[model samples]
Target: MTSRVNPQQPSGTAPVVPAHRVVVLLFEGLQLMDVTGPLDVYTAANEYGAHYVTSTVSPDGGPVTTTAGLRLVPDLSLDEVDFPVDTLVIPGRPDWWAAVADTALVAGITRLADRARTVASVCAGAFPLAATGLLDGRRAATHWRLADDLAARYPKVEVDSDAIFVRDGRFITSAGISAGIDLTLSLVESDLGPDIARKAAKFLVVFMARPGGQSQFSVRQSPRHPAHSVLRQVLDQVAADPAADHGLPALAARAGVSSRHLTRLFRTETGGTAAQYVERIRVEAAQALLEAGDDALDTVARRSGFGSEETLRRAFRRRLGVSPGIYRDRFRTTRPHGTRED
Candidate 1:
């Protein structure tokens, strides 16, 4: 959604309303949801008496087919646009890396972003923005699967794959498909008000607002392959029971190797030391417990294999950058008043 903040609207007064222009950039093979999700947010807001004029644009302003074999006809072509845009959104595609190499598309986006109040992207759309140098040295977010690729391609840009969305200056980026809705809702909240955003979210049946820094819903796993049968067995055992006797000596015994040799092999095969893997697995266990219920901190600590509350706190702070209590508050699921379904 496009917006221009009015200085005349004082903190407690009614906001000066204007019709904001929101333009979505489209191309062949774009992801359909990336285009529809954010559009739906602005449309819902407009239904609530918010003035959001939304439209779509393409290189030639023709019918663009998506990767899913669906077609989208644009409202305007780049050459036909005469008015200034308040917001410019670039949606992503499954084959987004191919789009990044399109110098013409990158150039067009660069020109539009220079004139727009805010430039945003969904998922791998960050690649094209990075190509134009707009995201250089700026924090950005994208789908977790492509986060490493984005960071590797654009060394200057700080990629935060864990985030659902990230706002750096006037440039905003969101994680995968449904996350675009979250980013648009945040923009609606920023431009209109929390009440309108909440109303829009309710109509859309989504959260009123979700934090940009929330982690993506995926479990972390070791990237490296196990080099031996014993290593695989040890890994499985640890995953099954984080509270098991997994110290260096015990793990070495379980693996039928010396402690020093186990350490070396674990690092070589798992790309992390045994102790590091154990700690990560323990943190994952702790995260599950924290999200499932409101257990005491000490109880959570022991159940997750941290042994003590202080140790759990330290581990949480080091790994997740939040205390156990804060993590629980953010992630714990709530049941309906009359039913247990979440």
Candidate 2:
């Protein structure tokens, strides 16, 4: 026989709920920030109300030392976990590929993920999840530096290196260290509500929501290989003065090369035309100006070498999938009252 609870006369009543169980899988030589960042978000949420209960677990339930030489004791062993997990988090190690070779650990992760409502990984932690075959046929994100490597190693997974975090079905993966905080804040927003998530973000002193994707933070350094010195010099100059005339003839004149040679050499050495590279640099500069202050679009356009607000808008939309105004609205940092703009 099945028992049914009464549903009548429940107006203005708050329903009692048990806290969501969050389990973090700990391992030796993992990054410390990956564990602490997301955990701090959950802990902060507790201040608002009892929304989540967090626990750390290891394969043997023993003390594990981090890559930075800090030791952490797990709250439980893998075998000791008896409750269903509402969320499962895995933090990454520097030598993450080596961690993927542990068959027993992979089996344990698969088992837990099977019972978890949601599974997440931070940075290189995606390695272990991909190793479990759970991430196969799914979209995922990881540290931008390791994105190509992740794709090469796990051809079955669709790796989005540009995304800060990606949620595919029950799985979620985040890019590098601090991105873990953003990913967890999003999770809090999903599980609780945006109001709680906004409060948590305000407490952390971060944007209630960051704009753009990992592309904004990606390194735009020139290639290290020695190929075309002229092209490299031209690229550096463009970066230094995006507002300067960087037409092919001007760049070629500055680099002491013919326009034909410059264009060919840039394509051969950088895998993109000189014009494309200059446009990307300009867009990046514009993104920075937008994030740092409340500048008018026209001012930002002139400073970023776009020369006009309409050009900046088109470039932003073509590259970043968002408008300049929207990007600024989401990413602009709040300035203190007494602080002066330099």
Candidate 3:
């Protein structure tokens, strides 16, 4: 016999629920915000008979301390738990990186991932997901600071530092702290529908639905003063023509500096290499195309420096975890300059 659950009732108050189970993995020193963000999102939707039953799970059902020192007691341990999980959420823990590497927590997470229908991570949690080998050959996103490391460490996984979240089939990942909320909202939208997701975002008072194309943080670094004339001129040109295919050599030639020198100067000034900074500019331009224009895929592709429609599709899949058409359909509006970003 099968049992059905009333979404209005909290978990364990009734018989076994056929509702979607969302298990949040709690390792020692988990980020409280990451854990709470999704919990809050699902909690808000529960009143409408759209419950996403959630729980905190640890390797041992013992008490664990969050990064903020709040003690959390999980409902189940890895060995004792047997819930039908539709989604497994791994919250970030920056300080626990070394500890996770030294412990069996990551291995246990990998095991849980195998059993769940979908696996998600917030911020630094991508480290463990990558460690589990689940992210290999998939497009994933993590906190910007950790993106290079995630990509370099797992060469098979294409990492996008700019995305707020990446949803590669069943595996979803988001950038740093607050981005977890955006990711959760996206999940809510997917599970319940856009109306519920919008309501949740509104209840939380988050301005606008954050489109996956919007950068985790904008790269609007500008010169401090007119005294920095030449650099500022180059920056304006780059901003105006991000599709111009300018690399370190070409940019350096335009700026009258050696490529090596230009790279060093760019890193020193912008806190990123010339290539990294230029890519940021290109991504910003891509966002414009996604939001502003209804140009065909090939036209948008060429304008965004992705070279071809196929190339844009590959990057779009890796960065946003969806195709261009789907993204536009979900977030685009017919009004002039009516984009999700706006």
**Where is model 2 poorest over a 10-residue stretch in terms of lDDT?**
1-10
Stretches of candidate 2 exceeding 4 Å from the true structure: 1-19, 48-50, 79-84, 160-164, 190-195, 207-212, 216-219, 247-250, 253-259, 333-342
CA lDDT scores, all candidates in order: 0.82, 0.81, 0.74
Per-prediction TM-score, please? 0.72, 0.79, 0.67
lDDT of 1 by residue, 1-342 (tens): 232333334556553467788989998888899999999998888767677788798888888999789999888887776788898999988887788978878888988888899999999888888999999989999999999999999999999978889999999999999999989998997888766777778778776555576567633453455768878888888889998889989999888899998888787887778888898889889888977787788898899899999999898888766677766643432322222211
Over 111-218, each residue of candidate 2 has an lDDT whose tens digit, in order, gives: 889989999999999999999989999999999889998999999999997788888999999999889998898788789875566666777877755532536263
Candidate 2 vs. true structure, TM-score = 0.79
Report clash pairs, candidate 3: none
Please give the ranking of all candidate structures by TM-score, highest first, separated by commas.
2, 1, 3
lDDT of each residue in 139-166, candidate 3, tens digit only: 9988888888888877989998888888
- Which of 2 and 3 is ahead in TM-score? 2
Candidate 3 has its poorest 10 consecutive residues by lDDT at 333-342
lDDT of 3 at 319: 50
Q: Assess candidate 2 and give its lDDT.
A: 0.81
Error of 1 at 85 (Å): 5.5
The runs of at least 3 residues in candidate 3 whose Cα sits more than 4 Å from the true structure, single-residue gaps closed, are 1-18, 222-229, 236-342
Instruction: Give the count of colliding residue pairs in each prediction.
Output: 0, 0, 0
